[model samples]
Target: MKNDYLFKGEDICKSFGSTQALKNVTITISRGEIHGLIGENGSGKSTFSSICAGIQKADSGKLYLDGKEYIPSGTVDAMDKGVSMVVQEQGTVGKISASANIFFGKEAMFVKGGVLNVRKMNQEASRVLNDMGITHIDPQVMIDTLTFEDRKLIELARALYTSPKLWIVDETTTALTVNGRDILYSLMNRIKEEGGSVLFISHDIDEIMNMCDALTILRDGVMTATLEKSEFEEDKIKQLMIGREMSGHYYREDTEESIGEEVVLEAQNITGGVLKNVSVSLHRGEILGVGGLSDCGMHDLGRVMFGLTKPDIGKVQKGKGEKVKNAKWAVEHGIAYISKNRDREAMMTLCGIKDNICLPSLKQLAKGGFILKKSERNLSSKWAENMEVKANSVEQFCNTLSGGNKQKVVLAKWLAKGSDIMIMDCPTRGIDIGTKASIYQLIEQLKKEGKSILLISEELPELIGMSDRIVILKDGVLSGEFYRSEGLTEAKLIQKMI
Candidate 1:
């Protein structure tokens, strides 16, 4: 058993100001196995993984790698000690080439005579990306030019370049598409086959069951259980992680709710990005779901509908024939967009919660052409409390919150604007099951209030469960459409997606 173990964290503990993230948690990962770490948001999974990966330090505890005391000064030091991590949020820096990002910390290898060998770095990066089964990306292209999923693949490529003995993937799959996920799964399997260990964290239980040989559950910063493959059970694991037996269905039970006949939003002959002559409409008081393969243009459709991206030769119009001009226009006209790229596009992370929530409603909260702090506090406080954002106060920094909390802040900002037409693109991505339920209930309530929602998601189950009508996009075209029915299934939806 000693020889089988590759890594161990003994009595690990971590804290942030007054909050205890990890409380004397202990875990171990054996060689050549994918070990899962799962919990609700703020359950200290990322904190522990980051500590092991040397992005941060545990306040008190011990870490052993290969039966040796391991202490890394930083991420680069960790990589040198045979550990690498792909973080939960975007890790790749923008404004640089993908090649530059892949060899970020190891630039000394490509530098000689006070000059960096750009060509050599590109060649090596190209090789690493191809080896990881990511061939579509150009190594020389700017990283920001790529989509969110492609950037995640780049992060995977960066991790693969290290060829570490242990890899820590922190909730990374939430940003990937189906093809990207397949590539990631292949990489994890390859690592195990080559006698390497992987620490995989995700909110998705089914994924953990399918991919991990063993899993450790956490709740409120304490280790709940460490179960082997034979002991893996969905209900049991969920109960342990959340500390409660999940009683009702995750999604809304009502499937036969009627939607208003009025068409609130429409995309007419839209053709841009990955979309080609696509047309769709959102009815008043309806949840219109868009689903497809990870590059099928459904995400782009959401952006276009929200006026973030202008179509090449088409128009997005409100029910009253008002052309959706741009983001400002969309917001002013009671249309709100919750972007899939939450960290970058949705809320301002560096800013406080009050500012983020009150941003879109600035004009509404201002008096005499001056925005008062009290008005900001009042409006932000109301929505923050309504959204149940767990933070010290409305003035708390957005960056300090957990993934689920950050998502709630994003939703709070939009809801504070009092927008009736909501375009939520992967709104619940990377969130825990508990938060997902809350958001689902919120969506249903919004629908009841005559709000139209254009829900764009990669998860078929989510689309089938929440949408009044589901549309599938395949290779930049609308392949099939289905009205919500008892017979609707993921298999039926997948057939059209592929």
Candidate 2:
């Protein structure tokens, strides 16, 4: 039997100035099927989706919806034609209530006789949230007060409210917890049962294999291959996406070396909103991994250690015998922090890669009480090459680089400063396997140099594989500690956390 196609794009091409982002790519989505798109950074997954959602127009090609030619000039135009997208970076208004954000662009629905109807909108919003299995958030509460994971759920709920025939979800699950992901998976199943098509994009291939009916692979702005469910394998997918087999050595080999005698950082009796009476010690030449479930206070601990947020009662002692009172003090003490919100906290989007990399190390680049142009350029170019940042040039704007490359730049900036203690919060959050491996190698190199690291991450495997010692935080306190020699496992760590 022949399958019906809900959406089809043939010979689609798009370019940004001289750089071609998509090269004669073709894709088709069938009704009631969840189609997965997999690729490395800058492989056109996001570009193709943007074109489908009407955020950008294809330079050349044809797009057909339900066997009819369709081309939308903007997102509103696409929505009017039963197409909607849930973005990864979040596009909702933070000052408004959750209900208002869901129905923001379609406010006319709540208008009656030239007057707004708040009661009707709230009732409908409650139903929509319930359909997505979200219960903790109130419809009347402002969006800014919600957590990042909750805001992600709201984006999905808003797309569902549109009653779209074609739903595009772009890396939306990265922020969600296990239970939240289950809710989203159930919602996708319901949509499929109603004969709706979904285009799911995620860096996690495991999720794509489990949820998608078929997979499309792109590499270097070209469609590499497409595979059916019967042909799905994690390694095979990785090979296709990167155009080579991955070494599978994500973490450094365990050399079983003892931590140095020197203490790099120490936190005493830290008390914050989600952290209470927290005390931890990090030594030189050590990678300390902090892990726990969502809301377990691990993230808060990182912030307190970095001095991004001052603890109500606590002290951070640095290697220089100086106590850090705030972020400025931390920086002065050779402490560098890479936040989880890379785009918002770690990067300067409008600046060039050279500027971004050299920003954190400006103190060293200045000569005679003025910035040295030649020194800055030499430093940035050297670090960019060493980190393998794939950009046209160091002068290229950071906003134009891919997610993995941007993350590399963020790391480069901190490494350039030669910081003694580094606090990495979700450093590999949205990067691909190849880039993640590079980061792991870099971390190992830093450890070999005797620099201390506090690695705060949500992935259990990463914590177990990389950290010399694993510290589990729960309810604003340290629950358990596991040494690498003791043989740490996810199940045991989780049991301790609960």
Candidate 3:
């Protein structure tokens, strides 16, 4: 007998105004299986999954649960039917305690009559965290105090607590470290063993191939193909997903010459929490890539260099000018940072695309003690067009844009500022191949213009492809450095990082 499908979507059609986001798409997820969704940017993967999780309704589709016709009005209705989604952007209140945030909506589980049961909530939260192997976090600690990776784990734990039969993870692993990813993978295996289903979405093809039983490809809002494990080939999957052959060289060629004599930025004896006695120099017209396993202090180094965090005993000197010790100082000194968490640190969701793109350049665009709307719009329009930001217009709100477009808008904002020094933290976290190519081109252009960039990314291929020099950090120390000219390999970098 054929296996019973836990969830099925047929003839799904979704539209955003005049744009058809999903066109006649159909997908079936069987119980006790992990279904991997692979697609390029703008490919209706997120939209279809969102519809499955009842975050949005499709224009035309028939959904079934246990072979029964099902249509949910909203997320709450979906949750009632044992469907839940952990989105890429964290959906938790940061100022609240972890326990409070975990059980925010389900207060009845921790509330008695008119009083809140803090101890019960804490106990339940602790149990959930422990089950997920998250030992560093305390239930009573504020969510704001936790790292991005930890907060994401907390979100996963919350989703698991819902006892979801079908769990949708949308690009959730981009923030997680190796250990955190392992925990999630183990949980997924357990969930599968317990007869639960998962819709796994990510840009990392290797992870999908390793963990998923089947793969579904989407492109231009259309379902292209679905392949079983036996038919899975990385190149074929890429071709079907993007409708084109993927270049093996995702990284840039090391055709650029050696660094010039000018030192654009330098950090000496930097001693911050998780970063000890670190020193590095960034030259003009060079891309300096920082890499390591998560917890290697590279992230903290980026934060410190961009002046987001203070260093205990270090100085960031720009050119021959004064040293920067804070974010404001970095900004004033023509230094900009694109954070790994684009939603939280980069874009303003409630604002318009034009506003988001021009935000970093407001001072430059101001005139006569007043903000110049025309200049802002013109500047934003130029960058939007150049960056190929897919939006109806600059007037469109950023929250309505896709993940890739939002990232481009963030990059446009910083590029509009014309910063001499840029510290990009995972700028392509959830972007598609096309957008990633565009970003690489932009970086190349910046390098040609003699700008200095310090790139901190988790994706090793990207670091290898784009950096003129790769710096590997391990346990709060600079463990190794490789020049692109010297032919660095993943093995060598991993060896140093570990």
Candidate 4:
């Protein structure tokens, strides 16, 4: 008889300031099993995993690895004890070479007499990439040059290189295309075949159901349920994760009419940086969704429209002749672009919620050329209430809040500005189903209110649900365009994206 347990987390408790990130959490993982951990944003899924991987220490918890007394000091210590994790955010250094990033913190193997062998490190990286069937990336290339999706792959490769007893993947598939997902899914299975365990965390319920042997549902820092594969049901799992019976198609179901006649925003033959001669128009009250593969240039299109990325070929214009020059100009003219990386680009994470919510409309909130503090707070409060943001107070930093709350703040900030056009890029990435549902409702409301929206996302269901019209891009070119109809399906959109 063999012992089934590989690791166990007992009575885990963690906090970040007043926020209880994890509360009395416990879980057991068997060797060779893929265990799924899920929750809404701020539900403490990441926190528990971080404790196990030694990235963050739990305030109170007993961790036993291989039935031993395991207390890892750091990431290296955790890996030494056979636990490795790929975080939700990019885990590689942008300025460093891919080879250096892959071997980061474990470069002692290349050190000989106080000198590092650069050649040997690159050779090893190349070998690993070849073995993994990744040929587009060069080991010598800097990480900054790679796209967001490719950088994620590098991180995945980095973790896989260790061949640890346990692997943790957190919200990675949300950022990937189909090809990227296949690669990751295959790797998790490979680990299982070698009698290793995997801890997979994702907001994609379908993925968790299909890939996991057991599921652990977390809600408000508490373990809600832990069920075996045999007991798995989509409705049951969703109910456990959200603590509610959610009804309705998470996407818009109405055989809806488009909002207005005026073309509010237009991109004429936009050509630059993965976008080649693409043209599109956003009508007032239209929810236009752009879809594509990971590298199909849709990300660039979002940035270009927002004036963050200058177009090499054409111009993005609002109204008749107002040329969008830069981000500042875009904001001044009532255009709000919510980036996919909310923490990185959209939110001022360290600042107070009031500041973030009042930022875009500070000029409007001013009295006689000076922004009144009372007006700012009021504006923030009004929008926060409208968006139903859950926060102790407007004084809390955006970074300290959950993913859903952070997104609400972002929306509140823009809504306060009364922007006519809102460009939402991956608006609900990594958030819980409940949060996703709220966002979809908000998008629908925005369209009905006669605001033009360019909804860009990697998730197919989101495109299918929210978009009045879906534009598909393939390898930096316009591949296909489909309008909202009874016959439109994810398969049709995917056929064009590939």
TM-score of each: 0.96, 0.96, 0.95, 0.95
| Candidate 4 global TM-score | 0.95
Please write out the lDDT profile of model 1 over residues 415-460, one tens digit for every residue: 9999999999999999999899999999999999999999999888
Show where candidate 3 strays beyond 4 Å.
1-3, 255-257
**lDDT (10s digit) by residue, model 3, range 155-273:** 88888888889999999888788898899899888889999989999888888999999888999899899889899898898889878898656667765446778888888899989
The candidate with the higher TM-score, 1 or 4, is 1
Q: Which ten residues in a row have the lowest lDDT in candidate 4?
A: 253-262
Residue 413 error for model 4, in Å? 1.7
Tens digits of per-residue lDDT for model 4 on 1-498?
125888899999998877788899999999999999999888998889989999888899899889896899999899888999997666788788999998998899999999999999999999988877788999999999997778888998889898989999988887676888899999999999999999999988889999999999999899999999999888888888888987647888876546577888889899998899999888888999999887898989999999999988999999887889899999999999999988889999999999999998878877898989999888888988898887778888887787788999998899999998999999998888898898888888888788889999888878878888889999999999888874578889889976
Look at candidate 1 and give me any clashing residue pairs. none
Q: Which RMSD values do the candidates have, in order?
A: 1.6, 1.7, 1.9, 2.1
Q: Show the colliding residue pairs in model 2.
A: none
Worst 10 residues of 3 by lDDT: 248-257
Model 2: per-residue Cα lDDT over 321-376, one tens digit each: 66878887787678999988887789998999999999988888998899999999
